[model samples]
Target: MLNAFHFQQPLWLTALVPLGLLAWWLKRHRHNDNAWQKIIDAPLQALLLTEASGKSQPALLWLLASGWLIATLALANPSWEYQPRPVFQTDTAQVIVLDLSRSMDITDLKPTRLARAKFKVEDILAQQKEGLMGLVVFAGDAFTVTPLTRDNDTLRALLDSLSTQIMPAQGSRADLGLLKAAELFKQAGLHQGQVLLIADGAERKTSVQAAKVLQKQGYTVSVLGVGTPIGGPIPNVRDAQNQPIVVPLQVSTLQQIAKAGGGIYRPLQSDDQDIQDLLTSGKTIQGKQARQSDDLQHQDWKSEGPILVLLLLPLAALAFRRGWLLTLGFVIIPLLQPDPLMASPLDKLWLRPDQQADQALREGNYEQAEQLAQDPLRKGSAAYKRGQFEQAVNEFSQLHNPDAHYNRGNALARLGQYEAAIKAYDEALKQQPDMSDALTNKAKVQALLDQQKQQKNQDNKNKDNNENKKQDGKNQENSSSSENQQKNDQQSGQKNTEPSKNADGQSGEAPQDKNSAADNHTSSSPKDQDSRQAEQKKPASDEKSNNGKEQKKDNQFANANQAMDKNKGQEQPDENEDAIKAPPQSSQPAPENTEPRGDPKRQQAIQEADTLNNEEKLAAEQWLNRIPDDPGGLMRRKFKYQYQQRRQPAGISNQTPW
Candidate 1:
């Protein structure tokens, strides 16, 4: 500890020389002595000039010197012990993205490109000292083999298990691999990292873009080209004939990706040099940041100076006896206050309201711009951008220029006054004949007006059709009901006449009539066999007739829907729900018993058919459940979902599957 003791900030020790001089000056010409001389008269100076031969001594000056010496020593930042710290955050966080494409199955290296790539990664993990390392594999899509972790054994085990067959699809989608690396870094809470991509070749355009994205997020993308320049044919992959599909190393393309990602690119080597170079990619990647090796997260020195501030406690406590707390605060506070004369470039202190408004508009503060703008046109534009369309229209209405008229039209259109919008746009066209925007907008608004009118007409026609259909249905229903009622009355009169005659002829007729009434009542009850049979028959027949009518109604709706394309925008009436209602059930004509609306035999046959269908569906489901689950099913589904989500709008390459 004694040998290690040294000042972290030696420059602060220089302050001691100046501090000693200040203390000596105070001892010779103290303020209290100077003030006493100024207050005393010449005759009284003789009486007042009293000298103490070191009796009390100048304690204040001594105290000042001691405090200054201690503060200077503390400010020098004394340190004795060593602390562990990372040289660069680079080596500490890395994600290895390995390609599992079919081309990786090519025997370019000793065994296979993928196998050699795995060995190279093993070399990296073996060489790594202190860092979190992760594994990711990608073909058609990427998956996290393992998140950033320190368990090299687990990573190696997982790496050995990876193969081309395990991937859901086969393509050298290194873009997805790089993105997966980014995800791993983020998952592990690493703000920055290195992504080492091992692949024979990748989709060039997408891979470059992916590298750039990672670079922006402070992640470098280094590539280890896994195939030779003199390429080899992919094993088990051929064309129509026995022709092998050759996959080559995209060396130049990979270099471009490295450059874009602010990293280094190296081809697969026999030694660990490639891995070593990748581990130190951050040195070149972060340049100046890597150069200042001592700086950790914006701080160059972890000074123990503040801890030494505890030595000032005695001096601080003594200062309170002389009211020095308020005295020092008053002196320091004035110096700490901002300079009144100097102004920042953004200061709006001297700017006019309109000038400030212009500045606010330039800065994209539309609300502030609208509030401060003195000009009507400027205020209108600001209001328009803020979505205050009504206020924007009012503001623009005050101005008569072509831009103002055009802007007013836009606001009016937003307010759903298409006719008024067209008029405003016309005004703009009159002012500037070649105002293409205004002319186009005028035509659009006119078309809107025309469409609105046509829709209203269509809605009226549909309403009339619905009303006519309802009235006709009602007429048919009333007629059918009246006719049925007449037939029922006639039948009822015949039934009563027979019973009444029998009752009038015999003295025992009353008892016989009562017995017959009781039998009729029993037959009408729902629980009775006759009543249940009648009800069961009625529903099936009614349903058959309803289904036929429903089909006809659907046809009508379909025909109307074909031509009803216009939007029912704000111009349409809201009170049309009743007029546009579906046909009432009470208005439908009764089904005829003569027609085959339903047959009991037919109903029974349909129910039996439905039961058979349900049984077959259940049997099919059970058979499906009997099949064993795939071990790779989860990975396949995950890859499929990711592939769907991440399909680039700019199409993927078709040059080679690898």
Candidate 2:
């Protein structure tokens, strides 16, 4: 217990000088010329000293100093007791170390060895559902692609930008790559994980030693070879006599590295067998569940700072008349004031407006969060969370930023106003063209709009059919009623006529009425036929045009879905899948880049591929597959900075930049 005594913040002990430690310091540095204290007795000195006197006032000085020391100790927050805490962790942690040396430029495997490795990485990502994965790339030096995370999208996005040209230096350094993998585990506060090294081979001899060190640290290292044993020369390079430098796959070196690290090694394969084997080699700790149960009852150190502050009361009591009254008054007066009390809620005294709103949001108080939010963006987000999409749109409409437009589009979409949402997305794209979310959402909303229009057309067609049937029934009823009236009129005429009158006028009039009835029927028949023909022609033309438009838009939507499925499935990509094909109404370009390539006629580098993989093997076969002209721009800057950091220590060399 005595050995456990230590300051939580030892630097705060400096405050002891101004409090009680200054007793000796004040004596040596005293400026007062009070010679009477040398001759005067203790009682006489106490009687003669005033409140303003410094060195003469020993009791008051010592009391204030002791109290200050106690207060400072409380602030330091010393702890002695412990409280239990539960911790949960997973053993499925892996760090993939990739080799980005110049030799990876060999086109023996697909478009290049590096491209095949990227595809393998994607496969592993898709397989690992609940594991934390990290990425590190190395050539002359190693650089982290990302820390251990369960987010596969981030890994995929970063992986797309990697290339042989991304590395600052141009040589193999597999030893540094292994060391970097170990560093990733240390940073994640994990002792055990699998280190998967995807490389052709190691050029440095120290790679075996580095692997051994990593294995000793409880990490199981694995290697996946990514090249043909037949060997291929590095692209765009020649010897002094203009001879290409041919480099073969060094399978033995990779095997040695795996053996030293106590892991398994496999060559790259088309199937998922290699990844499954690497994943199975994970080092799982024994009794994990038992340890977790015991850990739930653990004890962490409980800080005793508040209790220690009690010692200051007695010491401060002596200085009440002189010291603590002023300090205490300064602290209490602000709270006693009425200004801050009227302005905001009690939480505002401690937390910022945004913080208070976030706390309320976390507590499921969306209305309060909306009220507390000052920024338009936050207010809109809170309203959206509360299911008030109209209010969210209103709040988002006040801002001009791209994110504001995007959020407004979402709100409009939730309100079932797809056209408005699409317009909002268009506005967002106008400000930031590279916004992928906007592009994806806009395409979806457009498809939805097309479907909605098609449904409306079908509904109108049904309504027209019902109305036409009703009109035909009414016309038939009127024609039958007219015929009955005509029949009744003829019967009344016969009853009014005299019997057996030989050449009566009623007979001649009856014949004339019959002929008039026949003429009316003939004229109405032709008019009805012409009217029916015109209506049928108009609807037939409308239906045909609607079907054509629907088919065209539907095909565009299907193609976009197919492109996304290929991306997610990591399968062969079509030659036409250069860009996500959107409908004619969309503003996005069909091709990713308009900039010319080596073959100006063929803007893509897809022609330069290997024999093993099919033409549609990669959705992004080349670096220029996306909007960014240089896909590796971000990695180039990162490795450049890291390489410079390594060179900062002037006394040591970076082992000939390898």
Give the best candidate by lDDT: 2
C-alpha TM-score for every candidate:
0.35, 0.37
Task: State how far residue 446 of model 2 sits from its true place (Å).
Answer: 29
Per-residue alpha-carbon lDDT of candidate 1 for residues 380-459, written as tens digits (9 for 90 to 100):
98998889999999999999999999999999999999999999988997888667688677767777788787556434
Which residue pairs clash within candidate 2?
19-65, 81-302, 82-300, 83-299, 83-300, 84-298, 84-299, 573-616
RMSD of each: 32.9, 28.3
Which candidate wins on TM-score? 2
Q: What is candidate 2's lDDT per residue for 577-649, written digit by digit as tens?
A: 3222211221121222345556754633455443326534553343223332555775777777777566422
For model 1, give the RMSD to the true fold: 32.9
lDDT of 1: 0.72
Per-model C-alpha lDDT, please?
0.72, 0.73
Looking at model 2, which ten-residue stretch has the lowest summed lDDT? 582-591
